[model samples]
Target chain A: MAMSVDLPALEQTAAPRAAAAARWSRYARPVLGLVLPVALALGWELVVALGYSNGRLVPPPSKVFETIVALAKSGELSRHILATLWRVGAGFALGVVAGTIMGAISGYWDFAKRLLDPTVQALRAIPSLAWVPLFVLWLGIFETSKVALIAVGVFFPIYLGVMGAILAVDRKIVEVGRVFRLSGPAMIRRILLPAVLPAYVVSLRVGLGLGWMFVVAAELIGASEGLGYLLLDGQQLGKPAQILAAIVIFAILGKLTDWLIEVAAAPLLRWQDAFGARGGQ
Target chain B: MLALKEVGKTYPNGVHALERFSAEISPGEIVAIIGGSGCGKSTLLRAIAGLDRASTGSVTLDNAPITSPHAEIGIIFQEPRLLPWLSVADNIGFGLADLPAEVRRERIAAALARVGLADKAVAWPRELSGGQAQRVAIARALVPQPEVLLLDEPFSALDAFTRRDLQDHLLDLWADTRPTLILVTHDVDEAVVLADRVLVMRPRPGRLFEEITINLARPRDRKSELFDTFKRRVLTALDRSLDRSVRDVTDKSSAGEAMWW
Candidate 1:
């Protein structure tokens, strides 16, 4: 009887502590991730300050930040950022539209799959950079060529993901669709779309990453005013600080865009019982 | 009434899964098809559901031929097969897309309550336990109130306790709509408990071996002597359906083991 009385009190005390710990951990997670990078940056800064070596080649984090600040103030940063953003946006839209259509066609029809899959697979095998020259020659060294290059890079993964996802849809679930006597469009809208969405989000992220990569390659070849152009300009001028700043900006932008996709997709995929849902917890 | 006349299924690989199977089932009658493995019990059920086309003969429900899936037919498989993206409420409402929103909502609420999952409306399919998921599936199938509900060993994947519970729950729900039920299973106990008539089939180009009418009234006691008798008869029929030489070898081996013991 005494133990039972104590149990309620124990539970009452433990619940608040558990809630506090959960609240603390939520804030601590992102802070914990920042630890190593912050430590490394501070260590390097101290090393340079102590006159151990001249930080000419690598430069400290402060110098990179100063360069970024200077660029941002000059309005050049916004121009470059906008140019890169536009290219990626345009390329991604084109790639996604083409990929989804082709993927659906091949996935839905065996005859189309038999006719088209081999060619797409073979095209996918070709290194994306190899197409750079051909794209440049055909479309010229304008935004068209750059966007086309990025689109090519983005297309393969999205196509493969959509097609594979469609193919991988459980036959049993499709049978459920059939049992309802769903019309063709109703089946696609209700069943096929939701079934492929998780993989579609993953492929979109992958395609976006490739779009970033190919944008750099596209800007490296020719043209002006992008983050890639910044890299080339910094390289030619031997401005290591500028180059590092461009690299930092690239990392931040890439992560931000990917997070955007993840955030947008989270509500849609709330029903997923995947391992990743638990994450590190 | 649902009628099957000389229904046969031959696979492209030259395997005859079902051969000249025929039956006429009246509305609201619960029929169980039972056999050993590879007996095409599922094939026959699938054909009736219109998921698969019979290579020969025809299946007609209420004088209309069933070449493809009909709106009047609903099916439950061994697995729940719930769409992972939809909530329990939405999954139940899946077949009722053609209905008005208010009607759909009321019906879904009703179905949810019937299945005893009123609290799990917003829950995901993955969040539910196996039994709960199957219950949701039953609710989904019954929401549209299909004229014929085909079950392909729906309870076989569940544990004995859960299976028995679901079997009872299924009957309770069946009483509501009185839809013609055609169930396929290997479990004699299940067949005895739920089926009004048990049709036993022979393997290797599966054909009807025997039809046993279960005359027992509703709320049938599982442990009753009559239940055991029905079970024994079905088991004996199943044993006979197998090859005689194989049965002899197994019997002799079992007898040898018995002697050793």
Candidate 2:
């Protein structure tokens, strides 16, 4: 179809202020979504004020908030957050690059599928914690074992997601590639890679969650210092306050990292469909 | 400029698609091929386009025997076949990647402008209507400056008005490109509308049943008495061929048997 105008034209056609207004309007819903949590916090404060559970089984959100602040002040929060971040940083980088390339190979070549798919699937069946024992045995109870554990956890889902994305490239588009007489390498670069972006971005998001979970499990086994190490130390010392602080940090950090992935993915995804008839592919 | 000699085909399950078929196409001629289902019209086009090998026979272009897909010979299937990932401009520029980048860009621009989608260069394929996508397909074919363009029932999916618009646009492209154009379709009215020569085909070993040189003028007025007369004649011939299947009229090579052999 011959569309005389493009997205830029559409943007221009909309009232100039419409674009800015639309961008901010999307945020309204998310801000509203936090209302329930705010209400829960108020309820928890009242319950703790009423002397619920003698303040032993459940700590008030207020107390947890104070502990969180204290932990941040003492650099405990930043140290563990950074420590977890670095392990994931190393493992996630390796997993993404390796998985993406292998996934593409599996997508395009039947031979690669025969060679790689079964091995990855079999390896993924082993839980991250299950590998903890063997990893410590092999690499000792140091940073190496924890990073290895995190990498293993991050790799499988991403590989599967990437491979699925490659396989899901619409057959109709492949026909276009065929007609163009696109050579093998050119087809992958121009067609397959871009088509797989949606699936790959989602996989990257999954990688963050998987990596966080693995760190917790790995640290539970043994660790010098990390968020998981802090949580373990708190439980042993009977300091419910410190344990609450670490758990709270874990929850918040997971969310913030997930949001970061979305922020990074947003512009790139928009660009992919910039020229499409539809806004997103 | 292109010729098919004794092209025969049979499906794996033993259905005869074509038998001893032969047809010649000259430069700058627009030929419309029409046939019922299983008549091998598409298979013939595929064979000639070098997309598939024939069970028997040979195809030649510019007097050279054709074996593989020729860069100068293009085929447009029913769908527009644009890559979902690429923008309109990238898709139009697709096959020209081997050309210098600057030349490819210019050709993509020219092709898009020719199809009246210059502004949609960055638009994705999904945003296009069926007619627009087909226009992109046409633009894609022309971008490479192909010597021959083959179409397989391109407008059959479009609504009446959209189809009419495309027919005119196709005629415009034809006027400009002036390549050897061969279109395959099942619509008699469509054949009458777009082709210089209309060839009627029959099944049960598809062979040309009749060939009528449409001695009509450009943009042959569809509502004109002359068009109605020729349309009725072609429809009657088509009906008669379908009803009486005993006789066989084939598209033998214009050259005698041994010359092509």
Candidate 3:
């Protein structure tokens, strides 16, 4: 993107100018990653320029931009983003707490792992969307049901990741704890907890993504206040602009939340640098 | 004093790993148990460490029958099992639950310092070289100042030089604090170099074969004349034990007082 800006021509014979030109030339393909997106966006504008697609199937960026403005004016965009964010944060938190406890059981105790694994696997087979009716049936058509739905959706993936991380911990380390004569709780806290954290964190990130997705899906079906519900209401009211506005908000919030987690996790992962396995740069 | 009184172990699969094996380990003795792959050397160590229960007999530390893992016993397995996440200091401090926070920190620092890893107190296990990781493992085991230390071939994964160095390190640790050390190894030289007495075992339906005392001097240099003689004796005992396994296809009762020492 930087290289795309054409510099004013300076000299034809100077060595510095020639060097700058060479660098600019070399950067053309390396900068192609950013250029491709711009090109596609441009090409999308051309489609709108030609009118080969309708606003329904492919709303022009300009129209979507306008929808964003209208939603911002109404304060609806921020509301939806805040609502979705809260649900994902809550759901992700619940899922992590449950997943860690259960994951440790699956990792360390053969008896508990054998007993719980079958039930967990069975529950995981049910998709989050498929559970809408069941959640509503169990908890009624309210925020509780939607939150539960999103939590249920996030729980399994994180649980899977946590269990895998715990399982992936070196058997030798566990044995080391034993040789150190560590008691059960001390071993878990000192040895197992840190050892499995990397995996557990990765699972949480994945769960956050899945949880956000489920939050949107759950809101779409029966929500009255969530971003997904806003989009659905816009659809019912025959307002594509509102729907487009809702989508843009969703995209921004998703990117923002994921980025925030990564930023937050960076400090925790600095131990990576002590090992020099990852500079975490 | 530690003793295995008529110790017998049969795996769930019906493999007779040990049979009526009995031995007394007087205080501060370094005893090596040598056997082929399936020979219950590890099982004997596990029983002593109280990691596993012997089916028909009891292990005793000064006449107290072993029931479960106790702080008085430490066992180093074949692998260096350092937790990847914990720093070297924390790993060395892993089992020191009763220590006050300040005391724990001091002990952890001392252990890491002893292992020459004071500079790497905050380094993760993954940051360490193989030998360094194993040394930390040894440090973790030694930190507890256990009454008995069971080492199940704790240096087999290293190159010969590293193994020899660790053997020296093990001897130094034992010498400094004379914990009842029971080392299990398949390497004849390793057994001869480290042990005051080597117990040989036969494979498959494993039974103790013979007991040979190694009377070489301190740090028992492998290049020394005594080392070769001792290594030959352990190897011969191992070979004869393998032969005894073959002969056991016919004579099961012959594995008698050979184990009772």
Candidate 4:
């Protein structure tokens, strides 16, 4: 539509208010969000030192830190972390791509949905770790099995999220597509994809977190060098500090990956933020 | 010419949305279809745009039957319906995807200029105000350079001031492009302000009740007596249609009662 008005002028006038809000969010919110976590860590250190649970099961925070520092000095920390990272990256990528393709196809076409949905739904009920034995038998006790397990873990949330998002798209917008005489492929590309994107991103984060959880399960079977391997090693060697360190690493890594996904999706989600702003107007 | 030859629509569940709805719209003529809720104003417009089909009879543009949505027929629904993902220019240029990039850009730019949103080419639809989004919708509809433009309560959701502003914008557009315009609305004032002739519709088996020609000059004053006269006339016709429908229902019941009496 031809609209000739000067939007920049209006935006310039509104820019200062938006700038102030952004300034507050950029600096303050993250610090505020971190407050509880930092407090909990300090409190946990005090409790363990004060003989809570006899300081054996949980280990003292200082002991865990020392183990982390020792591991870092020997470069074992980097090696294990890198190994886990690679597996998660490979598995998550494969899962999300495949899930999105299949989800979009089934969501848009009734024929595809009819053929694939029932089986996918039934399989989704089976836990990701349940496939560990089967995957190991087929792919062996190597990186392939570990990655495949994580991939299976990641796939379901994304598949379900994308399909649900597509189904939930406003019928009014689809009618707009029909009015424009958009071809079937064109409708899916322009209308369906964008319509489902915000929910798909949320599912991506969920799938990534699930993939991390399954890493331990995958590594429980003949894995040599990952965070999961560290956990098993600490258990076998009877080292509480090492096990605690692995748990800490998993927690931090999970949060970090979720943050990265959100950052990656910010551009796509900008329109939604603008939509909320328009509502206030 | 755009023509509906006794076009009718009956839903699969047996609801008669429209029946024998016929009209002849010459090139550049502005026609408004006004009816109360459930009178099938939107159904008629949808049938004309070929978004929906007639159960009986036919809708034609240039004598070719319209069985499905034709690109040459542009429509503006009640909501702006701009794809939230696209910028204003991209939304306007959406239907023009088959054109070369340069030609499409040129057309988009021209359309933006026409709707007074030339500077908003890169702005997202979410950034636009309700009126602005509606204007973008108008641009999107007009950019395709369609032979017939159909609007279904296009400004009903807007506030009075915004609605009036858009009404003026639409008139300017009609004056410029002169495409055969068919607008469906319930507002009597809106019908009188923009249409060359207004067609009133009756409920139940929706059909045309009467057609009133609006002979006001360009940029018709909403405050003028002539404008009020046309509004009153349309309102009277609307009242007549409602009364007639009610009477028909009572007559049917009374005929059964007469046999028992």
Q: Provide a comma-separated list of chain B TM-scores, one per candidate.
A: 0.93, 0.93, 0.92, 0.92
Can you write out model 4's per-residue Cα lDDT over B1-261, one digit (the tens) per residue? 998899889989999999887788999999999987888888888888888888999999999999888988999999999998888899999899899999999999988998999988988887789999999999999888889999999999999999999999898887777898999998998998898888888898888877778877878898987677778777877898888644422111111132355
Please compute DockQ, using alpha carbons, for every candidate against the native two-chain complex: 0.48, 0.36, 0.22, 0.38
* Error of model 1, residue B129, in angstroms: 0.7
Model 2 Cα lDDT, one tens digit per residue, A1-281 = 23344567666787668756656666765688889988887888887798674666567788888888988899888988888778878878877777777877887778999998998888878766777788889999888888888888888878889889988888867656766677888877887787788888899899878988888888888876888888898889877877888888888888898999988877657644344324222
- Candidate 1 residues A1-281, lDDT tens each? 12113356667879788778878878997799999999999999999999886889989999999999999999999999999989988998899889988988888898999999999999999999999889989999999999999999899989998899999998889889999988899989999999999999999999999989988998899968999999999999999999999999999999999999999999898877777555423
Candidate 3 predicts chain B with a TM-score of: 0.92
Query: Local error of candidate 4 at A169, Å?
Result: 2.0
Task: Name the regions of candidate 2 deviating beyond 4 angstroms.
Answer: A1-24, A50-54, A126-128, A271-281, B10-16, B100-102, B240-244, B251-261
| Model 3 stretches with alpha carbons more than 4 Å out | A1-35, A42-63, A90-120, A134-140, A162-172, A222-224, A233-242, A263-281, B245-261
TM-score of chain A of each: 0.93, 0.84, 0.79, 0.83
Pick by lDDT: 1 or 4, better one: 1
Displacement of the residue B128 alpha carbon in candidate 2, Å: 2.4
Using lDDT, give the best candidate's number: 1
Alpha-carbon runs more than 4 Å astray in model 1: A1-13, A279-281, B245-261
**Residue B216 alpha-carbon offset, candidate 3, angstroms:** 1.8
Please, what are the lDDT tens digits per residue for candidate 3 over residues A1-281?
A: 12223565553347587777667766774587679767876787788778877667567777878888877789877787777778877877888788777877787778888999999999898766888888889989887888888888788877788788888877766766665566788877877787777777778778888888888888887766878988899889887867877887777788788888878876666565345332121
Interface RMSD, all candidates in order, equals: 6.9, 3.7, 8.6, 4.1
